[model samples]
Target chain A: MTITLEPGRPKPMPTPETKHFWDGAKDGKLLLQRCGDTGRAYFPPRPFSPYTGTRNVSVFEASGRATLHSYVIHHRPVPGFTPPYAIAVVELEEGPRMMTNIVGCPQTPEALPLDLALEVVFVPMDDAISLPLFRPAATPAAGRTGVSMGVE
Target chain B: MSYVPGSVAVVGAAETTHLGAVPNLSEIGLAADAALNAMADAGLKPGDIDGIAWVGAMRPQLLAQYLGITPRWVDGTSVGGCSFMLHVRHAAAAIAAGYCNTALICHGESGKSRIAGAQRPPEPATLNGQFEAPFGPFGPPTLFPIPVLRYMKTYGVTEEMFATVAVVQREWAGKNPRAMFRDPISVDDVLNSRMIAWPFRILMCCLVTDGGGALILTSADRAKDFPGKPAYILGSGESVETGMISQMEDFTSSRAFRVAGPEAFKMAGIAHADVDHLMIYDAFAHLPLYGLEDLGFVPRGEAGRYIMDRNTAPGGKLPMNTNGGGLSYTHTGMYGMFALQESVRQVRGIAPAQVPDVDISVCHGVGGMFGASGTIIFGRDRPS
Candidate 1:
């Protein structure tokens, strides 16, 4: 028999500073804020540039390419997740790290190596919201070489 | 800043009468119990304590009112599990500056029973709720192990090495009657225990316990007046990094640990070889590895081998977590207070698992997952 678990995973309550980033995920685009002054991009979207403390920041679509920096296979029961899923921190090609889930792959040490290439995949929690998750890149061309140089 | 060493001292230290599980004691009760016991141990009354410090469930004012202490100075520096370590540093500074003649630092948590006002869920619009919480990072067990897996991959530390940390600490626990889990455990037992997260078996994690501890600080000049032996505060340091684990400057090493440890050592003017006893807060088995390396106790990437080689076990070159630590001892949420208690016991020649001829003890603690660190060095003798 299959167990049906309640959707216990927390959903982001978008703020004015983060609404664009969440909307971008709903539109299937990985949007990151870049500082026009320092030419540095960062994650967990904010209104001002962290480096320069300047409000001169704008959102841009990223290539959605990242490398698995570190992770753990959480076996304990989380609200919406089944046991034994990968909780990962992936370093985006734009030089920011993001806390996300590694989906579409087995959650094992042998399968998930450090620096493994990953691509963004959006999962819609509801009609008005979507969350960005990552999975192993489908093609060899989807690796680091495919990272957009336009970011910073 | 010129490093001033041994200006203040810990005159009294004590933990709640019952450690493992006390269903009757609320979180504030636990703190009060420990605080009163420590004051009695130092031959002090509630009126004598002029300063108060606390973290987590109880605020300084609430604790002060509950204990009948009208403190002129207060500090509530809540930096996760290591908050008490920072408290000690602040208390010592307050005493040295003549802000208060006597300062009491207290900690209490109903971590196991959740009897106290336990942590409520983060607000939906908060930074954590908006960014990291949505990803299903389930508390410290899931969040803390992430760096360990990466550290293992980066430094070639093995699963067995992590298991050894649990096994050796259990040996120390076996000697303590107050330890929550005192039975002996082998590396195989650790490896075979139910896995909570990859690279972390259940054995590697700290026990959920309901307990509390307190410390009393005063100027070193007045230390001899205390009924109990004084543990001079030779040095202290604290630092905070990013709140999110992903933003840590380095995955393999904690920057906060590096900064805090060196600052303490510099302030104390002591070499690594002078540290006769050490307590690295072991909320998880891998923490000692990071602590050992980052605190300059061992070279980088060598702490795993150092433990595997039996350098930190009983009858080893250096004794670590001699009270079984949070892994085998009681972890009442913020564990730094307990670590401080053990260091004081060691310095006063009263620890259950006491090491011979010990003059100095080092206690290092981590707050969140590599987010903040505090290091304190205590000595048996006052600086000349």
Candidate 2:
């Protein structure tokens, strides 16, 4: 017997509130809105500061480095996705709570190590947009060539 | 918390036909039917109503138009399965405060049949719909079952414990002619029922009942003037926790009850043992178990044990869900309304299937996904 995996469909167009994030993903970057003055990160991507009560905000690219806080293994498929998947809440290094999927590994509690290091991977849904998911990054050798960058 | 001891009198209570599927009726139509019946039950005309509160899937504006009232006060709190109970508390407080002389709390839903072509309600912007909705949890059966599974794991409870609740509720329903599933059921039957979700057999979940229920509240002094029997709402309380299902603190604990139960009991000036009858929203079987434990009816995590003792069944110590609940009776979508209606009826001594010597009735409704909870303690007399 053989098993085949079905590819999921991506979102068609970005809404006015989410265009910047989707556009950044197309450029191979994970974008988040950070307060220009207070340096606080906002989610559900709002125009004004949910915190600090300041209107100064900017869309900045994220490092997508985070720790796995907690997650659940869903045995059934949701709209636009395959079943037997892991849906997790990742606590980004920047201190924002994000809901995303875990990938590139078995979807089980044993394989999903809590507080494990992760890196972002972009999975394109439609022609013009994609999503930023995270997975376990490859461990480097004794002398690694590339240094990871962190944005201020 | 010291104010004049006020009373919330249920001068009116009404419902649609106690049967299955009434699809042709719009949400507003059903609400109107219930509101009118309630007014008639109270022996008051539509013109006498000065306040309105509703709970259901329908938007507030739509229900307002259905009731044909431009009231001085209005509340449309849609708390999933347990909204109607919440409305009773709100209506009671509003009546006590003199916000309105006559207030009506109404609920209606075509659970057996939804609007054929109506668009799906839009999800809130704050929700992580993109991430959460994709995991086969768009509705109640899937979302509610998660907590039940976790509770069983934490307490080391078994499906049989939950089945005990279902069997007992079904037995009560067997006596209720209005119950959708009145046939007698056994624990073995519940265990063998089809699985709606993990650990929740179809028998464990509420039936898709199509109906509506309404209650009219008035001040204690004003209630004495009414013609029909009046059930006094002696005390009421409400509490809410994290709104998102993904953000709930712990599946094993209920934040809403921890907050609301004490406040309600305190206001009622009664202990848990004082309650005569319990009419809890039976959206799912686990809810009553959670309610029993959360409201201090029994110790925490002992809900399974308390229920397993065969207490909630017919002739047991605590006769709960006497109307059969959504599991057997008509859920009517917003089941809280039914719970409140039953509570008022039980206290007024006019209920269709009366519980014996019922002077006090505690009505509870948990809206959202354990997100919010409300309780109203009713009695036959106002505190002297």
Candidate 3:
């Protein structure tokens, strides 16, 4: 029997290694693991801290605020991406770098100003989970500019 | 312990089945084929190899088991494209410190067949896959295309200027019977090939391939007695930068190469002018262009034009990527092993398309998207 796999669909069964991350997405929060002893935030959500040699690291919700450290306007779609998207490395105010798409805004190289303030927006996927994405926050000038949607 | 050069000499190099799509060979079979050839070439038995370094793209332990050898020292440094070159540097250090007498570095891939029904290993620590892949980045082609535009924007480089490098390398591939891409490609053909990403034509990207290659490295003292001519490891260097693609300082510069190149030259005790031939990695076309600049082959932002005028192609003053390259040659996931293998051939005076009077050849391997770097400088016993 052949089972067809749908593209862009979340896995029907989440593995134990990825369960926590998927669960956090369901609750509309970006979760990061921090070592309880050192308070150092770690990614990929490991259960142990290689730094402090401590086990049982704690997982906590990251503040939804981040600053756009840098970004690239990619025009090609790999396996899962829409063409002409922005992949940005956002530095969380809480002290760790996260890679996320700069969405809900114009996707242009000019829109990627360094250190731009951004607010996290959770995008639900197939009703099973949400991906953590960021959008430029509303500002006096941002609102006054009539929300420029594209690079003119 | 920190690695000091001079203890390593590449004694043997070999490749598995080449050309056409090969589906019958398992990944392990391909690796063993290459490893055994390298061992036979080195005039050493499998039992003589105490060190084994392999790119982690394939199953490492399976390769060891298939070869019927358990190594005293093993490394699976999978930085990306430069995996094999990096292993050479690490193995050299290990050999010098009396860790092993003979070292084998190998890579194998069945990418051609894997394309239909391959499950990529779940990525654990990579932010690029989780966050960036969901959006787009088109792998290396899409990610690296914009950078060339940025390079052109800052340097006034034309598309034709970049095509010169591609065209010349294709010409070189015509001579190498093992190269998968042997047909002559012209500058116009490169310009006219359908664009994958703006500023990057389809011709500019490497072809997906399935093959394997291996190298044997031993102490310089033992190298004198090896079966073939020895390619001495004059210098080697490695470096890593911020892994995030977007966090790089600029599109035109590879900080990893910038940091690794100067130090590699320093350790080799040579300058760019002294290099008789170069085997800079060509994961993408612009990579070699930029790498040449970082290696001081030309002034910054001038590699494309320099390649055009100097004809740094196979017959040019500085022949580069003579065995095709990652771009025109087989890019079986990782291409660094091929670069080192070609360098060994060039220095040994037995390259299928040998460039005469080769005294020193420099090979540069880049992993990730300019995220990691490993450079090796090889010198023949006598300077040309």
Best by lDDT: 1
Worst 10 residues of 1 chain A by lDDT: A142-151
Docking class of 1: medium
TM-score of chain A of each: 0.88, 0.79, 0.75
| lDDT for residue B145 in candidate 1, whole number 0-100 | 83
List, residue by residue over B1-384, the lDDT tens digit for candidate 3: 654455579998898856436787766667878898888888888888888877774456667777877788788888887878789888888888888888888877776766332336325335554544554455677555545655776688888877777788888888988888889988999999876665567788888888788988888888889879989888888888745565455667888888777877888888778889899888778887889877778888888888888557766888899988877778887788889988988988888889998888999988887789999888887332
Interface RMSD of 3: 5.5
Query: B1-384 in candidate 2: lDDT tens per residue?
Result: 343334667888888754478877766677778888888888887678888877534466666666666676677777665666677777777776778888878776777777432325335232544434533354566566555645775688788988888888888888877777877888999999875554567888888867787788888888888778888877777888855555555666788977877788888888878788997777888888888888889877898888778787778778788888878887755687788778877888877678888878888888776888888888877778
Kindly provide the TM-score of model 3 when superposed on the true structure, using C-alpha atoms: 0.77
**Candidate 2, residue B140: lDDT:** 67
Over the stretch B151-216, how does candidate 1's per-residue lDDT look in tens digits?
Answer: 887789999999999999999999888999999999999999999988789999999999999999
Poorest stretch of ten by lDDT in candidate 1 chain B: B115-124
* Per-model lDDT: 0.88, 0.72, 0.74
Model 2 misplacement above 4 A: A1-123, A127-152, B1-6, B56-70, B116-126
- Itemize residue pairs with steric clashes in candidate 1: none
User: What is the TM-score of candidate 1?
Assistant: 0.96
TM-score for all models, in order of appearance: 0.96, 0.79, 0.77
lDDT of model 2 at residue B123?
50
